[model samples]
Target: MANFIDKLKPALAGSREGPPTSAASRGPSPFWVMVRKEFGDHIRSWRFVILLAIVVLACAGSLYASVSALKDGQSASAASGEGSSSFLFLKMFTETDGSLPGFLTFLSFLAPLIGIALGFDSVNTERNKGTLSRLLSQPLYRDDFLNAKFVAGLLLIAVVIFSLGFLVMGMGLFTIGYPPTPEEFWRVVVMLLITVVYVGLWLNLSLLFSVRFRQAATSALCGIALWIFFLVFYGMIVSLVGNATSPADTAAASVVIRHQDWMMLLSRLSPAYLFQEAASTLMLPDTRTLNPFITQDQAYLAINAPLSFGQSLLLVWPQVVAIVAETTVSFAAAYVAFMRQEIRSRS
Candidate 1:
């Protein structure tokens, strides 16, 4: 009986080890596995931890300032029927401290850094370490590698942005003793989504630089240069060009109007400007439009009547479309560059 049991055990072990599974047929889905690995890497890295801390501290400071300012304003206006505590959540974002900018302003300024930091070294670091070739040798395709990096970075951005936004809202509720209206809540959600798109454009831009440049330092410098060009220098350049091209003081009204339109077009070319216009309009219900060409009749009609959520969305639809287009173009450029790149490892 013991000998027969031993024979059956050998047979069972042999059956269990019939054939080795192919790479494609074994393990988890490549895309998801890659995504999980990259996402975990991002969250565990010191870069992400430092950036997250900085952003959170900035947000906390800004929120504290805003709440204090709102409290003072409310106390001063207690006698009057004005300064109702409506849209407290929006106010937390838009209200300033007289000493510091509001929460939205901080987000607009610091958000680009998060995207750029995550992406600037994404590919180059692997290449520098001679891991790119080995990584590609796995069961995963090059598409999976690139897609995982992008999707992981995007998911991280969404988590950070949404978390901060909700934190602000929670703090505002406690400080102001009021919750957001349904419309205001939806507006905040839309603004957050728009912000994710805006940061994603920067992420793709950085990723493109990473793929194009072999050295991580070169990619980082190029990414920062592009950001500075658009954020700091683009507006000045546009203003100079507009001034040079504008009609003389004696020119016809139509000619000056055309010059103004051209200036607006150039300004909108800056992603920062587009983001500000869209976010401001979304958070501030009283804001009707960012256009400079509002006629007297139109201005009068908009007076004292806050735009509804749908109306505000319609006004900013073009800006939203432009952001999406810019992001797509950036990602496409990175994809093409990475696909065509050679993957060689040191001997």
Candidate 2:
């Protein structure tokens, strides 16, 4: 019996020397492990909790405004026989009681803050604490770390955005006792997706700054500065340029069209403008032209006619694509920069 046990002991030793057949060995990969860790950290962070509360309060205020406005408009719409033709679900998003902006407006303004807050210190915080080099010292690829951080932030954004969307829908349903039509529900879903992409742009931008700057505050300030520039100053700059280069009042139709085209190109450079344009078109099916210069013939064809779901999507595809492209560019820049960045352990 002793000889037989000894013979089997070498086999067990060889198996232990080889890859251990344990559950830990079969667990998630290193990339996924990093992703989970980052996700957990984001969820438990105080900044996220505060931002979430602010967003919820703002969204609730806007929602109440919308619900009140809808209730007040119901009588007028019913008397005029417009209630049946109107979209109640969409109104819950776009309507307000003259006190607050609608849900989309609030989301557009606040989503960037959430993205920026979540990502501004993603890398620099680690480096400042002398853990970035230690983290990279593990059996993890450089891209995996960066990619995991981005994916984790994006996942958090999606969770928050989608939760707010459904909350609005649920509260509206409970208060108004009306469910959205299939088309309206899908439109809302698409708008939520666009909001995610919009926030993602800021996330990647801040992540880029986090990689480039050693200080978290500097990264955050840089992100906020760009956000302010595009939100407030970019539009003014575009308008000033448009006014300086405006065609005369008596200019030819083609010349005026050319001028408007130039202005549109410049304005579209702002992601907020693109998001607003896309959200408006999706939420309001009556929108036919992104530019204010629709021809008489085109206007005649669109009079009293709402666009179909597919038509609305087609109209805003460029804006959606543009936002996506900008996000991709930002992420790629960050990825390349992080890969090239050198990390040294602090003694």
Candidate 3:
């Protein structure tokens, strides 16, 4: 009887193993596997750790300044009956005690650093180390490898940005003793998403450089140089163009508005400008338009009435679309370049 049971066990085991597993039942796809590996690498990398530390410290300092300012403003707000506390939650992002800039200011300056650091060496470094050829030598397709790298970096950016944004919101809730309205909460979520998109623009740009340049340092420098150009020099160039194209001093209001409109269009070419406009409008409901030149009609409009969340979103929709378009174009360029590169193994 024991021998019969044993012989049956073998048959049962063979039957269980008889059916071949389909691809879907096999483990995760190669693309996802590579994504996980790259995401883990970014989290553990020293550069990422250093950048995150700097960002966290900056957030802490700005939050402290903002909270102190808000507390001081409370008395005036209560006495005036202006109900400043209504949007108190959003103010934490745009308000500061003058010693340090607000949260948005810090984020605008530092977020790009995070993106650039994560992706500046993504492709070239692997190639230089002779790992690129070996990685492609496996079951991984070129698209999977490239897409995984970008997707992993994007996931990391989302994690970092969303975490910090919510951390600030949580701290504000505790410190201010005021829960955000649903509208304010949604606005904050949108702003954080915009921030992620803005950072992704830089990430994709760096990825493009990594694919184009053989040396990681060259790619990194190119990324930083472009950042510096937009942050510092681009505004000056815009100003010069605006001035050169300035209308006569006695020009009609319509003419002046057109000139200003053209300047606004030119400035929007810079992603930094687009980001600032979007962040400010989203966080501050009082903003009515992106135009710097206020027409007489707008000047006569009431100042105390803040736009609803939907309205604010509509106002910034173009800026948001423009940033997304730029990011997509950059990633597409990188994809094409990387796919065309020849992979060679080296000792």
Candidate 4:
């Protein structure tokens, strides 16, 4: 009877010759395999395909729109007098200027949508599809799963945002019939960086929301609601507060507003707004008016602020650090939340 049972055990265990297995000897550690499998799964996902398609379409659309606008300008340029062709084209784009305010407005509004799309179901879908426990049982740190999601999200943003900027520049040159000037080139570069950061910031933001909520519907709704509040309602409320607190006297109003500077300061707290301010500083001339706080004098001072790009980097290093810090804190909280969740195997 013992011999027969042993023979049956081998057949049931899939080899008829293998040794007994134990949890302690699963070969690779959990963390590495999760990361490895995650990378593979990321590339193979429908999300990846959608991301690529969105990138191509969004960039192509922007290029087409800008070029069509530029082409319409070309006919008028030949007939009417111009101080300089470059100057005229500059004026048109200046109206369309890639200043911080403009960049922030466009990117802040656009990015949350991308964030929602990428993260709304990141974990819940896995949980619903019944892969969560099996994935958790693997030899990986609990945090690794979240990390893989973040890495994939950021990489996708980098690829898409970068291509958009390059295409915009190419279309600009085609329309202008000359390469961008030194100042113009920096503006475009600044625009590109902020676009990436804006999109990437929301990657973690949306992911954090996704992980913290259990019901897929709850997560998706919160993710989108948070985006709306931050992007649209935050500004509106800030403006309302400013208005509600305005002084009775005109002179006091101006002076108090200047002294408080709360509106401008409050604006900076929004990564969206800060990104705009930074972009404005990078892209606009000394005269650009992105914020009331940054006057012509302040703008000039910033431009002439005895610093190389490296030095400026160090100066704005706080903002960069702040962004990193915020993303890290949110993601860390989400990581802990996920690790604490009950793992039920549905499949």
Candidate 5:
């Protein structure tokens, strides 16, 4: 009996020292482990590759068009007395080819798709493959999974946005033969950051749908539907509502002003609208105010010179706040939904 007890004691001691029993004792935090896993998976996936290639090609084409237009504009300005020859580096982002939209416009249009693509299947795919249960059974907390996914998606977005912004600037420098001014560089950086935030909002929205729906297709379709509604139909609806609420006769300035303000408020409810307003204001320094009802004095102040970077940011600060608030609300909702979700896989 003494020998038997001695043998068992060795076994017990070996088990105690063999492996970690708690998550913290692991080599790294589960959150970071999961983040690295998700980021790698995203970068390697065919979906990411295809989408990134599309964006790069589109940007390259848009930059080509913009540079050509800038050259023409510069030559015309040299020939004419009306055009000003300042901030040519900044013009590369804001200037349009005959009918083509600028680089910023292209970004605003496609950035949401990238975010949605990254998040639409984040959870549902794991569940569909019967991995969610196994994954959660590891030494990890539930929130870690969700938080890691959100952070991974955000990091992906930041990389892509900043890379493209830098690429555009580099191409512009080679072709336009001028570097961006300090103010222009900072403005571009701010625009890129805002774009990341804008796309992050869509990422959270899609992630929420991913958590709520068991099917990936359903979540993807829901996200696309929301995007279409905001991007296409929301503006039309706002216009109709404003016309319906407006006075029939254009006699009262106050009434007209009220109607315009109501329309602006309603339009801002859409993330797409908020992003466009903010991106446009950031890219184009000449834009002084988002408010259409600026007083004569304000208009007079803005006519002779472009607003400083600080003033431009100030003008769009409300839009920035609204976008950030919407992003936070979406992420919070996703976090709650994921936390309350059942981990059981459907047979």
Candidate 6:
């Protein structure tokens, strides 16, 4: 009996349970299990909690501001009062149906925060946890881990965006004391779609950083640096070049016509900016103004040379494709890096 016990203990030394895991026991779609596990791990992190808090706070601010605006509406002499609570809230919260400027602006402004949170430590954490080798050991295909990470990040994005949008919508419904019209709902949906794409771009960028950097902090800083370059300086460069290329004091028609070339050239360079413009177009169908370029008439006129809804899609296709393709490339790179990485040399 003693001899048998010693032999059994040796067999079970590394096992977590009674039975050895067989291919059959591994079950169907291990990728899903991996994604869910990643999701769970991320949601529990302080970073996720903080990110959710920011979005929740934004929603709450909208509601509180709406309530204040409502309480102050119609008191013109109140000095702090706006014309209407509902009006201001609608202006601030409503998606630009055929305009992408404000939504893109918001995303450009907020993207670094999201990107840093989602992927700052993607590779290093596995290395630190001593799980990279084991994760690579799973019987799934070579790319499954990478695929699972992207899927999990996307799910996280959906949760954050929809939650904030719904919260704002709820407040609007209550404060205005009426349900959203179909148009508004659909506009919100488009805005949400844009949000998904915008966040995806950042996630991909950060994933690249995650793969290339050995330290989590270095990856995070590099990700943020990239965001700053694209969001902050990219527009400055665009505007400067556009102005440099332009003729001054032209008629509004010619101003638009001539500037359109420069602006399109400028905007296309950054998917972040293009996404903002496209979001405005898709979400703010009824927008009276989107940035300085789009007037109420121009918003729907296809004047920016979109030519058609299909053209608009084509114009923004790079942003959409960049996001998905960037994610695939980054994840693939991470997989390759992990597979080739020597675990023994890892610190």
lDDT of 6 by residue, 1-347 (tens): 75998788868776755566676766658899889999998898888888778756655654555455444443543565543323233444532322233323454477547756797787677877778777666677656776777779888887878777777777767776656556557656666776776787677667767767788989888888877888789888888887787766655776666577668766666767666666656544433333456555666764443133344445545566665565566656766775665654256
TM-score of each: 0.92, 0.92, 0.90, 0.72, 0.92, 0.73
Q: Whole-model lDDT, candidate 6?
A: 0.65
Kindly report the root-mean-square deviation of model 3 from the true structure over all alpha carbons.
6.2
Q: Can you write out model 3's per-residue Cα lDDT over 57-119, one digit (the tens) per residue? A: 999899999999998888778788876666889999999999899999999989998889999
Off by over 4 Å in 3: 1-25, 79-83, 301-303
Cα error, candidate 5, residue 189 (Å): 0.3
Question: 146-228 in candidate 1: lDDT tens per residue?
Answer: 89999999999999999999998888888888788999999999999999999998899999999888888999999888888
What lDDT score belongs to each candidate, Candidate 1 first?
A: 0.89, 0.92, 0.92, 0.63, 0.90, 0.65
* Candidate 4: residue 77 Cα off by (Å): 8.1
- In model 4, state the lDDT of residue 163: 68
Give a tens-digit lDDT track for model 2, residues 109-214: 9999998999999998898889988888887788999999999999999999999999999999999998899999999999999999999999999999999998
The C-alpha stretches of model 2 lying farther than 4 A from their native spots are 1-24
Distance (Å) between predicted and true CA of 117, model 6? 0.8
Candidate 5 residue pairs in backbone clash: none
Per-residue error for 319 in candidate 2, Å, reads: 0.6
The true-versus-predicted C-alpha distance at residue 82 of model 4, in Å, is 6.6
RMSD of 6: 6.5
Of the two candidates 4 and 6, the one with more favorable lDDT, higher being better, is 6
By TM-score, the better pick of 2 and 3 is 2
Question: Could you report the Cα RMSD, in angstroms, for every candidate shown?
Answer: 5.1, 5.5, 6.2, 5.8, 4.5, 6.5
Q: lDDT of model 4 at residue 256?
A: 75
Give the Å error, residue 228, model 4: 1.8
Candidate 5 global CA lDDT score: 0.90
